[model samples]
Target chain A: MKTVKNESSKGSPRPAHVLQKSRLWLMYPPRLITTPVVWQLGQKHKVITNVRQASVTDEIGIVCLELEGRRADIKAAIRWMTNLGISVEPVEINIIES
Target chain B: MDKNTGFMKALKCRECGREYPLEATHVCEFDFGPLEVVYDYDRIKHSLTRAVIKSRPQSMWRYRELLPVAGEPTVGCQVGYTPLVKADRLAKRLGIRELWVKNDTVNYPTLSFKDRVVSVALSRARELGFSTVACASTGNLANSVAANAAAAGLKAYVFIPSDLEQGKVVNSLVYGAHVIGIRGHYDEVNRLCAEIAGKYGWAFVNVNMRPYYAEGSKSMGFEILEQLGWTVPQHTVVCMASGSLLTKIHKSYQEFMKLGIVAESRYKVHGAQATGCSPISTAQKAGLDFFKPVKPNTIAKSLAIGTPADGFYALKVMKETGGAAEDVTDDEVREGIKLLAETEGIFAETAGGVTVGVAKKLIASGHIPQDASAVLCITGNGLKTLDAIAGHVGQTREIKPSLREFEALLDKENKLINA
Candidate 1:
């Protein structure tokens, strides 16, 4: 099958497959604070990782991370992190105040 | 607009400062920051004076101008104005010079402070033309939303953890609300509701409608200030679930001071939590700017939010005001409940136990100075969480209703007491 370029009505070029962006909060346990997990994630996964905010202490590390890539790759990346004992939650979940 | 919007201006992102229309949406699209209801304080300053509030009926709606509703409240109108009792006996026991109990355990309709938030959310939901309202609650919020929605004649659905106490489950079910029991914890229930809120377009009080819903807690603080003769207490101890109430109470004090309704005064707003689920308190105690979520395992189910949404902001408020945070064990929680009940005749839930227990520790540790005045916010009644204290409270002795038996029991009790 011939791949058609994904484009808007204005005909600007885009990725062949739609890219999805997700914002997440990644919580690292005290032992995982210095693991360079984000670097490893970018090297291993097809997704791009951006750190929006981070607070590191001896006790714990919390990072506001934004991920952009194919949906499946993002899911796999999150699953990998979870397997490593990292807590991954959507940023939207933080909107609830009750 | 055909109806007045009270004094609310718009929903503004707490992080990015972006403004959105006062709608059901609760997060900023660009940054995922929580949106909060912003008010036109200049207008509220003129309209919501002490005289205007005094002339109104005693309810949370008495502060309508500051609440984020489009018009007069139509649901749970009788909520709030719960007594702020002088807790002299409790103060003496806790080693504090003065203390008050904001007794929200008897808040109208529902027996918890959730009634205040539900009233505001439902009122705003009606204005937004929603016919069905729902929420993801631990227990108290479910009870409040169920009861209030029934009285408002709106369809209601409340999702809660399947492991909630039977008393709370019955309270919600008795109101005819569709009470769903999720297999996981409250955070999971809340996650599912966030999706449902988007897909079904129902007014999820703590999800999409949170900005307005959270403003309801300010009433508790406003009442505290007014009941204290319009003066901010030197210290306030509030229990945290998502830590929303603590932050809102701080906001309430700030709003009153900004409006000149109360004189500017330095006050500390301490936070309390169960040790089994104390993300906010742990972070505050560690002097950290953020908190790591933990799986909750505590008798204080109402305050068992492992991943508190407002944990960061709550920490900021506590640190900014020079406040302290503390957590109590399950044993200490029971002791706190017994202390409050034996001293002040107030039967509070585990959350209240956490507050009372923490207040004692804070007072003892000098975080709350021994001589300073304080207020403890009791957010719920113990009846809803009887399971936590069922076997822990002293048992009743079975006695025959005969004079001989009564005399024998009195003699035995007197001997034991004397011993």
Candidate 2:
């Protein structure tokens, strides 16, 4: 997969003027627990995914994911997850992550 | 590293599989994930025995193996080891089988639980070669940072919201720390301080030094377990702000079990919040794993964190333990303060009032079992938030300066009481 850092189309427009990076804490409900949403997000979208922490149970799957990609792609990925009944929050996941 | 230091592994990211040197950094620079203080637990388990812990001074430092500092704590030497009073009177009032108050309102120096965290954060700040330290706080945290920083002789700057109670502001000013009162809420103040933390190299206890600062809260949990004859309580209710304390308390219990210091036992962890700014509790009640941030509007200023950073984790603990989270109204907060003071003689701040009020609600609703042993965490002194219960607690009766007048007043008071 090509790095999303330098995929701007020239003369059309740079969707994100600078590199867009975000860290999120996502909560996946029981029904969506079996789905490979995070794996699919990386393959289908122009994004890099890194999971910091996760605690999965039969009822819920909580994951802290860091997505580095174009702003538009990240938003779309979040929207897709939201549509799947996942809760995504833009948290300052690292400063005091413990 | 000295033998006194624990086997600290490295700063690891919770979101991304990344590792960094154990330094002053707190967040993952690669992906903005929070860094955690990882330890060589196998090594810690070998050295951190109950006997070794018992031999150390009766302070939070006794649990040094779990803490993140590299050397002996030089600051806030008198912090922690707070009295965990078995409140029979309060238990009778709540109609519970047993009750304990982890009374941090009398915590050393600033008289709040913030002393435990600040002590560790500043100790790490000094070790990391930072000569100045700062923090963005509501009230209690500022007082703690100001007082601890002054004692350590480190240059200190405390940023706080302008609307804090006058006592907290005065407490900080008296410590000779540079106090900056931003004319905004705590959330706004925190944002501005984050920007300032980036520009300046000073160690912000809850920002750059957060990973270490947060580890300090584990001591409160450790003390509870140790105070209860090295056994975990059936239920522990902690006041929530950023929600770090609740998570850390839970973590402390898990660590104790993991290290073989305590036997495997089921203990529930509950959280307390004021109705004005209870994002975590509101989410827990709604059966949601995520919380929507709200603008705080409660008298529990110390707990007026609209956007709790650890709300998700706190909810996870609550759900996993089959515990509960509840919030109390401002009126209930004052009543809680009065009930605790009148019943147990422990005058606590508004956050304490919130804890007591929520405990009462949980008990009445049968969420907290009728006979389960429980502990209510009281985090601050009531004198700091005197305004919350000013007119509500009633004024002192005026009496003539004479024995005859005093006798007459006593007789009148007795008649009124009987009536």
Candidate 3:
């Protein structure tokens, strides 16, 4: 039997120094729902984009995604996505500690 | 030895009924439907007798046959079996006949109902060969996860919004868990945790291990019935955040009736929410099938889930059970907390306050009758959320050490000169 992977479970060193992977939810307005922002994100930056879940309607669109790249490149891509009218937010916000 | 010996049938899709192995997967790969735990009732009915359950320890494990865990629970063994107090004074204040309070404020360790779910989730996480457990929590859930995971000796990572209550943050940090503060709303933290779960193979109690985790909530319902002489209450008012607890309690009642634990009777499960972030309650009131997510703006931080994952199921339960949903303003939440404290001597958190406050409205609007027996779910303690009602509860009065000074003060406030 193959062994189960537990590298991350072993309290591995933080990944914040080099490569970074982030899960983001992007909400698109009606006008931008049809636009290819996710496609352009890959073309414009050195990032790997994977769509985890998406819901599209006539008025609004929401997409849950996984983005992997260098920390600086990922930051640039997120800023670009925000400038293009897509609301970019990180995942797993169960606690509102304000 | 066949490792899976329990009566658990399989994990079936809620929408399509497609079966999958009892693994950590929560959604169907084919249809993306949420997977629900299924059990063989015939086998459970034969063994899960009242005497058997009564003979076990008083912790949530007493209902282990109903829970989804396979092996003996290795974590949070002391959780559950909280007091279910009969609130006569609270009932009189609300102009109702009989009222009960399922007080989970005194729940073990973290002192909230979340301990029940975390206990089950961490146990299943260990059984599934995972060494790390994580969650994206509002506040109570983070505290429970941190405390339980510490006792279980598992690596824990808790993510929360940067603006959570100081008490809740301290509760988690005191348990020595790795706490990460995200500079966003709870929904954003939830999304990030989901992504992290996908990339890293840690067991996120509410995300990846959700099917088992949610089953823990049924214990609350079971205890509610068991404590009430094995009878269902006419109405059960629950505080809703992600709406899972309400739906699970409804399921628990149904499960008990199905297993011959209680005589079947008509019962309604009402959901309560704070108005600032009431997606489910708003949808239910508008008679809509879906809820629109909102940016949360409430002092009841624990109940600030804008996009409740189980909102649809919760709405369905409310409709099918002839129940109504209501939301309370932040001011009403404080008032509700004070009402419970003064009348029942139970200091409940804002979520509990929301439950009490919404129950008050439901009674006034004739949704819940004044004479009908009801149970208001007090999910968390007021001490964790003191900031919400700090300036509102009233200031303390100073009295001198002498009876002469006290008499003068009393006479000044209420003149005794006539006497």
Which candidate gets the maximum TM-score versus the true structure? Answer: 1
lDDT tens digits by residue: candidate 1, B1-419: 22656678889999889999988888787667889999999878878899999999999889888889978899989999999999999999998899999999899997899999999999999999999998876678888899999999999988777886676689889999998877964444554555455556688898778899999999999999999999999999999988899999999999999999999999999999999999999989988888889888999888877888899899999999999999999999999999999999999989899999999999999999988999999999988878889899889988987999989999999999999
User: What is the DockQ ranking, best to worst?
Assistant: 3, 1, 2
Off by over 4 Å in 2: A1-98, B1-5, B163-165, B184-188
Whichever of 1 and 3 has more TM-score, that candidate is 1
Identify the superior model by lDDT, candidate 1 or candidate 2.
1
Return the TM-score for chain B, candidate 3: 0.96
Q: Rank the candidates by TM-score, best first.
A: 1, 3, 2
lDDT ranking of the models = 1, 3, 2
Worst 10 residues of 3 chain B by lDDT: B185-194
Candidate 1 wrongly placed segments (more than 4 Å): A1-23, A34-59, A65-77, A92-98, B1-4, B184-190
- How well is each residue in B20-77 modelled by candidate 3, as lDDT tens digits? 9888878765545578888888888987988998999999989888888777889999
**DockQ of each model against the real complex?**
0.17, 0.07, 0.21
lDDT of 3: 0.83
Error of 1 at B193 (Å): 3.0
Model 2 agreement with the true structure over B125-205: per-residue lDDT tens digits: 988888899887657788889999999999999886777667677888999999887886343354456546655778889
Docking class of 1: incorrect
